[model samples]
Target: MTEIPMGPELLSPGQSCLATVEQLLDFDFDIPAFQRPYDWSDKQVSELIDDLSDAQRKEVHLFLGLVVVCTQSNGRFAIVDGQQRLTTLMLAIGALGGTGKILRPKGGGVSSLWISPRHADIGFAKALVSTSSETEQTLSQRRLKQAFSKLSDQKALNLATLLGAQLIVYVAPSLAGATGLFERINLRGKDVSQFDLVKNKLIEWAAVEKDSIVRGEIEDFITARYDTLYRRLDPSSKEEPFDSDKLLRVHWILFTQKQFKSSDKVLTEVDSAIDETYSSKKSIARWIESYLDSLVRVAETWVAVERPYEATPPSWAPQLKHALLDFARLGRDGELQPLMVAAIIRWQADATDLVRFCEITSFRSALAKKNSNHGRSYKWRVARQLYQGTWSDALKQPISLAADAVHQLFWANTPYWSQGEAREFGEDLTLEQVGAEVFPDNALDSTRFYKDYRHLIHYFFWKYGVYLQHSKEWADFTRIDISPFQDSVWFGNEERFKGWDIEHIYPQTPADRDTREGRAHLKVMTQWVDHLGNLTVLPVPDNRGMQNLPFIEKLAWLREQKKVPFNELLATPDYRGNLLNKPHWGINNCKRRITEIRTAAAKLWGFDAVRELGVGPYDNRLESYQEDIEEEGGDVPDNSAETVAA
Candidate 1:
């Protein structure tokens, strides 16, 4: 019998069969350009691999669930369902074995991947199949590289050869049929998320109650939400976005006051909550409606909160854009998300204060380090309180920062004020008393800070640039199409800054730097070279590592190339006066630059809050405070005393 022609073959409508990754590859599959990119988190990827290992030990065939595909105009299969699993299967092939042949649809086209990602990452995926590639990359590439390391070479090959995972392929003749099937199985059957589990129960109840309208609403609501949010959860996104499952889980926590104990636990909690709804005399239709309503409240805002530096400020709360960004950066483990979404919902009229409260509280938690697991222990409670209207509205206004709070941060190693002495109070604080304060390489000594403070440098400088841009707001920058936090642009890695990197105003290594034959003219500038003042965010090609080029040439080349973004460090008056007009850059210039940047840092951080913004150190963000309006106009105490210990 003639072998079926390679690549997509026309199959009868409704044809279905069990297939392995090997057999599945016979069809050339194309993910629509609009489909969500590869986004399995490190944990998710590891779990998939672990699941394979478990299957291997049991000597059982892995039965991964259904994959739905339909024919495209090019005759390649458009992946309508199971993209994550299919892509991961290819990734597994590329990892445990060479994908040189397996990656191609049929002919092993040099330009094609068996599963083509969005147009931009097609090459990156191909490079991934090859061995001895770059170890440091971001996004899908980084996660993929990490996934490749999970098994030993012999073990990987063993699993690749011996493990025959059975996947059910439901091949549809047309896109419309594929989409309908996708919505059904994707929502109802994919075990990756439990959204469909609770949803199915709701529909079942709806059917029993004969509530057809609400059932239809649930379907429409879920379809719309998933379609809109899928791409937003792309692993390449810098926003640390949530998958649709996490959104439902967070909503569960918000209403139930339960921790995300486990996937099984979530279903149990959801089931219990469903029982509670029924016992409370609430209609099943109303139970789901209420849950969906809460989802609607936070789902859109939840995503907007984590947008990177290039997106325009969201129109609903443009002023709170930086606050949202800062909050997103907090507890990068997602402890802040539930609280952030709840704040937007509860205090919709006062977006600024609520968003900033989340920002400041998240900062306080960061200061507390591991001691405060607000995400695991407290954020859920906070979110629940806000939802139930039990949390004091006083939290909607700024919490007064204690005077002692600002000094340790601004003054660095300075001695704390004596407990006996009465401390001054204010809406903010400043570094008016810095001369006597010094710590050995403490954070305040901007001259001493360098690459050791990478996170601080990137986050703050980008923030400072934002501050300068928006009439000195965010005390930060607001756009997120690219990032300024990274010192170098990573083309295909997660957490990359495609447009910016740290630029040393003075070449860190000039041709003359190593040619110091006699120590007559040059002092050991090693310590000062990486100082905070010497660096600023600059646009990329990185001009072939221009940090080594002669200073004057850098100015001319950069000016000619317009390698400077319009609103960041280049636009500052300090940039004009310090480097643009200077004929030479030396240790003194870096020293001079530090003072200006530190003053900005003092304000950008909470140090100079009172002097700069007329609010407490934690309240530098505008409109993030108001006079106490509680029944007694009581002062909301600052519970985050550990703010300076960090």
Candidate 2:
């Protein structure tokens, strides 16, 4: 092994040099104490191999990027970056039957690299080199084996030549300088995520602990929670899963009740907050405990926000869970998440009231945010104040406070609109008023109801279907039932909305019938083609099977299937004389059919009161809301149903 002199000349930061892989790997590399295990999965390793092999095939020199290293006085070097590439190179060379140990240092006593210095056995490379079959191979190890399989003798020799002659590395003067450079480069690039930095800080603190017991416990905590948190934060990523920085900001809001404006400052802000609050060691210990608890709370809160219906509805807080499901169905927004976390923590028992308050607040706030003329400070200010209180303390205040706050905020911000004008208000109406206004008996008159507010169709079905199924008269519900409707889609082994389709009562077929009577019938069907009266929900298979069939034939098929609640409701004999029973369903029958259905819905939802509250000029507010959400990288649920041909 050739020893390159490291002197004052090479001690400068950002010093550039051209060195072969053999020359670079000569000095033993240390994988610093704070670093995570070698986690480059098989796919990544294979890509590196393929890239190098392709370079060899094309006879092009491949420059493997900077391997930032900190030179130690003991003639060894600590790798600060590009360890995955270096390690994979060694593995590939080893598979090629190279016994020279050119990848490792001179003394057989020590190898080329020290992975996780104090915890050598904890990394993937150690498991690979060790003869112990008991060692649990990680994804990277499996990939190493797979990468080995891809290498033939000639290819391996070519790779060896490339490694010995082609690679370049940038070595910084000292370990501290190199570490700083590593951090800056990675933080500025995609190489390192905020999660990695935060993890390093925690583990670095753990490494400094005087007590072994405390250190071990912290290490164990990190091991248990690290990947779990990472996976939860980035559910989509299996390989380089790292999206928990936003989560840290959420933690900041939950703790401080204030927004952390800069995502990059999240770690520093959180650290400062912790340092300020927990100045003493004992306090810091307590903070760690509380921090772990917050991680769980925030993670669970996120899951609830995105997938409320996924969990078994909490039996003790079913109503709150139901309300959360509504929030989830409405849309998942990060700004709204803190309030939900607070609700779940404190006021979950009053789930119905809490959900109503949030629903009203969410609509008002979203509108305010969309209209840049109106500021969002008031919403955040009130949220901080409301969320800081305990459940009992929160409940002590008037339930109307939320509505009052929203109205007051809007009144102050939206000065363009008349302050006293009820016509400008949308969700500012009371829950009962909202229900009535949104689903009045006369709702059938509006053809716009079908395209807009499709989500409410499920809600209406849940309420009326449950009432009918329980043998409670619809009239009885109108007068006395104040209980919130639980979603029937969640009942039984039947998954919620798995097979449900939005079906048109009248199909959208052409009026191509040659005869006069047939032509009139076709025109009527076409006229009410998109009416909510003509729309109902059925299972996908049932809906598919009913395609372009005559209304009577479709009705007969629905009876056989008995899969859709709303369809089954329409099939019942008790609700005849309306559009459902017409021998030849025409436009008038369509209007009557929807009118009866709307009346039933109005009994539960209070549609007339909603109408009295006055509608907004933004009739397609949901469409705009959806567009804004999509623009912000949020997903809006597709609630569109299948339409029948006229």
Candidate 3:
């Protein structure tokens, strides 16, 4: 790795150099790997020049440096960096030919360098230039030629001449060493992405046979399809920096092999399996070739339909890609037939329309065999077959494939039972039994099953609710006081006893103190009273009238209202000893009662009563309010009597 600095003299226009196009194209000089493509529009470029001119007229020297790498071929240079500067300079030069152009010189012609357009850099350079024309210019051989011809004919050749005359500092190094140097220099700066590396590799490998058609198609597919998936999965991190190698590895996994499984299994456990099967470069290359061939076949089929090339492809491409990967994983697991069926269902059916088809089929297949060891045995068998490819022949028959795969899952796993005796000694059940039974074993297993099938459960419950809205089973619930001590319960529902707002509970204003001392005392009091357990939802009218009342006064009011069998209930051993024996008896009793109510509510909801009894899920009545809002049409009224009762 050596750097040879070129002198300050600029090269003359129209001078030929021993430059091969490949030297200039070998690396991306302007945009870094992770950076988005060049997006500066003509308007932006024009504005930039206007700013530069304004600065120049103000006598501010804009220092711009050029860095170029000389190629092995003499007089030839590959732009290692600073292509943005060079490109912009050329665009400004071209605009100077038009007098009204913002980037044009104050005086046109000679001063503007509008010289002969037969400059050597024209052919290799036009792609990076943009003009204020309607026609979209793409970087291609034909476009380059056309642009060069127009510049020459219009005698706007000064642009290229001026660029050629700019001071260029050159550093020459061997290609192998240049890569290491490039990586080091870019390590802390704008870096290349893994996708770029893969794309470059594909292009280079295909270039030998001029077979870029497939490569181009794949690039377009990734840009339009897979990129959206990445964005969806990590929206906030979408623009975060990425390593080129990591992205290439991800692309290889998705595109090349069906080695990874899609079992709704978390990645933590499956990562080891992935490393064992598809981690090698050689394995990835083989997989890529096979997958590419399959895609080529699909593309050919696409071309045969309707107006062929003129017709756009089906919108199922993304789904097909995901399904294909899933199918491959299933095949690897030896569950080929079942996976084949799943693939067909995925291909032919709309997931929304055929909601339970896949799950039902999979469930039915598992129920076919009664042996307790069947499910585990089948999984093992599938794993073996994946490596052996024994079931590869049956993949084409989609229905048989699905049925057989599902059958294996059903028979291999044991059916769950409600009682120990039933679990240990139950007879073999049919698919219907497997689906409908809610045995003790099933209940026990539901925890694990729910973990795996949570998404499906949520979907079905939501959909079922939507469907049942018009059914007789859908009933609007009204709050009713069922307690024996109705007066006390009602009193507790009002501000006189329970509707103590935190702010008033610990009043900031001291009865006879200076404002600052009163505020300090209030802050400490507020901290203690602001707890959720201290707060209670109550009737707003009652709350307004009871603000800042003393605990003794509130207790007396409650007694007068007969809200509680106050003397007896408060005197009971359990209540007096456990709840009322605190230093702060009123607050402590209130907290204990709140806990009891929350536990009861949680039990009614079929949630863990003890787990939710504190000032947590059970005490948070917001969900109940939300459920009410969902059931009825309007939002829950802030001061509704029902809300106060809860």
Candidate 4:
């Protein structure tokens, strides 16, 4: 590899050139309408001052990151990226009275910034630089006041910060280029991903093409799609959110029929995959453009499929939602993420078969087989068949895995269970089959399959309770802590919403563990505790209140919820019977409740041959909350059903 010698700029990008903050402020920049208003809080303004002060003290140039812009008429430029930072720098310089000392106002104005009308306090922004103060009537003015106050507090904003703070400025040949450039630079990760490299490659090609119109078209295609892609694709509420690496890892294959090798870093894996497959430059470009298009097209539905906490899923397409949620419980489906992106966006084929195929494959693998090896065996082969004629998958072949063939196709991918056959899956399943299969019974005929499939079990009960109540929306779930670096999503807020959790009907520990009989009784409770029959959802408060109480007392408490305000649990037919008459919830109760729930769950989760409209399945009650279940998040795994990678 021929190495390019590095420059003294704070950061390096081959396609971008360096500029100082002082050099930047003298040039006029038209803040476009799409740019967000200048609304930096006092803390943000203080931090920016503190950062530059620290850098000045250290006598080091701070890399201010990339500034992407497109040249406009009158020697001015339209701000695409760096609008926020650039605007702040202008305010800081003006507060320090350095504006008049700088050279050019090419627009021949007092200020170089052409504030967007969307900026609520354009008067205040202009006043800050032009020495005519505006009243703080709007939120924009309030924010501007804070920034000016901070800058004035510094007495004199350092000339070193303006001179030594370095940034690379990319003058995009067109608006499309500017947008595409912004997209690449804004990808939230320390490592450069394939998306960034591909954008860089496209920029290199556009330079070769040199035709502004052609370059614009290519960039325009990417520009139109990426806004939606970045906004909706990543579950921001999640601790470790999705990034370019994840987008490439899981969905890249569906778009390009490329498999991610275990050894591959996200940066090289994609480039290598494309290089091996598409030799021609034209083929590679077409595939990337289409993949980006597919990503944008799939983004909304994908977010819906992996909706975050505190958001209620739309009530429409209830069956599909339930199936997606059930699939989520099986853990993150890397194989399915690509397939789902394909199903929802790129493919012309029907999605029922796709969902059905993935449902069975994921369910059977995670539950029955307990490993996804066989389920993921033909991952790329399926992609090939599905997208045969598309640019990503170039082989012209007939599409085969329709509704009728979906079952057998999955059968081809999955390993046969000791007693399993195609019909056992293809045909409509019974509670007996679910008991024997999906949530299988152990050698003692007790495991009650999917018990270990934690997310689904938790989700099922939560959703079922809502379904039973005929509620319009899902209840607020306590967003669990996933990142040790960051505290709870609601860190400073009230702790009242501990969110709901899995509760065992039969306690895992005896309330009187201190006694010999309590210890002896605990042995009996452990056998049935994890089973679906033994499970139900309860609020953290209720679960704690009723936890380790006797079975009859728990049932009586549930009955009290019927009259209790804000009590979601109803002692309906499912919970009522001779159980209040009995002291303990026996194996017979587990069998009966398990059967009832299985029937309801089968209908809700779409195991039934026909789609039903009116109602859906249920899941719930208390075990002392275990870390394993809470820690293994996502009613869906972070990677499996929703996305992939750390």
Most accurate candidate by lDDT: 1
TM-score for each prediction?
A: 0.52, 0.56, 0.31, 0.60
lDDT of each: 0.52, 0.50, 0.31, 0.50
Give the higher-lDDT candidate: 3 or 4. 4
Number of the top-ranking candidate, with TM-score as the measure = 4
Q: Which is the better candidate, 1 or 3, if ranked by lDDT?
A: 1
lDDT of 2: 0.50
Candidate 3 per-residue lDDT, tens place, 560-609, comes to 43221222133333433364422223445545543433333223221121
- For residues 332-366, write the lDDT of model 4, one tens digit per residue: 45556656545544333345446655655565455
Please count the clashing residue pairs in each candidate, in the order shown.
Answer: 23, 18, 28, 21
* TM-score, cand. 1: 0.52
Off by over 4 Å in 2: 1-53, 61-64, 67-183, 186-228, 231-246, 257-297, 309-320, 332-334, 347-353, 356-379, 390-445, 454-471, 474-500, 510-518, 525-527, 573-646
Model 1 agreement with the true structure over 510-593: per-residue lDDT tens digits: 655555431312354556667776676665565555656655566665555533242333334454345332334556556555
Error of 4 at 145 (Å): 15
lDDT at position 267, candidate 3: 25
Q: Give per-residue lDDT, candidate 2, residue 76.
A: 61
Model 3: how far residue 302 lies from native, Å: 17
Summing lDDT over every window of 10 consecutive residues in candidate 2, give the lowest-scoring window: 637-646
